[model samples]
Target: MRMGRLRHAMVCSSNQNRSMEAHSLLKRHSFDVASYGTGREVKLPGPSLREPNVYPFGTPYKHMFDELRRKDPDLYKRNGILPMLKRNCSVKLAPQRWQDNAADGCFDVVLTFEEKVFDLVVQDLSNREHKLMKTVLIINMDVKDNHEEAAAGGKLALELCQELEAVDCWEDSIDDIVAAFEKTNNKKLLYNISFY
Candidate 1:
């Protein structure tokens, strides 16, 4: 709304997949978008379910990609991590933690793809000092963490953003917008208002 487009933040447990997928889509649509993770460490699938490759928040996507490819090119490629990292590298330099990004500035809307992440984002916002006194809408639409689900969720997130963009005053029309979206998409959404 600031520049005739809603500034958005897409969040998930790890910025590598779901959030990044939506981030890419939103960026392509020319939305002011940023993506983040709620997890303490960035975690990705390893060779087995019991093992996961972990990195600190600031590790470059290229580094993770090269390291994973070196560790097991075939396995990572098969599991879609390689391709995901390649796509992530193109979207941004690294995975960022939501808690660590308070100074990154305000967003008009923050969308999380998981309930836990929504909680984390809400908690983070609540704990911050409300210097801007700006109201931000936080919405959660459950999205499964997988290639197909991420792709589908990205499109759905785009649709929701477009709906919001079309409104002259989002605050006044949010209820109707959410109701229409839920009825049409058959998806329940959880939303809250927080200050920036």
Candidate 2:
């Protein structure tokens, strides 16, 4: 409704997977895109699932992968996280959290991949001191944390994003955008897949 390419922010529990995948897809479509996590620390497997490495947001994906690969090549390969991390590195500069987005930098729409993240972002937007955030629309479409699931979720997000960009909603309100988006897809833009 703000009438140009809608600025978007995709979020999940960690900036490592789902959000980053959606970020990559949306960015490819030329949407003003950013991604973030709601978690306190960046969580990723080191040598195994039982001992995940906790890192800061801006830590490079390659750096983490290299570290893990150095520690145990077989374990890193078996986890299959390396491929996902490799893909993520090609798109995003680094991992970040939802809190990294400033009030002044709030996007036109903030989409979450999980219900908990949707609630967290809703609250994050609500507590913002900037009134412009009132115009921001937040929607949650559940996506499991895996390669295929993230890819499918990213594709779905792209479709919904395209619909939102194409439609000409007269009213710039959040409700109007939501209504128009749903109307464009002829279905609610909610994806819940268990293929993972």
User: Top lDDT: which candidate number?
Assistant: 1
Candidate 1 residues 1-196, lDDT tens each? 4355589999999647889999999999889899988888999999787899999999999999999989999999999999999999999999888888945868999999999889988988899899889999999999999999999999999999999999888999999999999999999999999998
Over 1-196, each residue of candidate 2 has an lDDT whose tens digit, in order, gives 3345578878888648888889888888778887888898899766556988788878888897787778777876777777777877888767877787544364666788888888877776666565432366677887878778889889888877776677565134446656665676454544221100
Rate residue 129 of model 1 by lDDT. Answer: 90
Clashing pairs in 1: none
Q: List candidate 1 segments past 4 Å from native.
A: 1-3
Clash totals in order: 0, 0
- Can you list the residue pairs that collide in candidate 2? none
Best by TM-score: 1
Query: How many Å off is the CA of 183 in candidate 1?
Result: 0.6
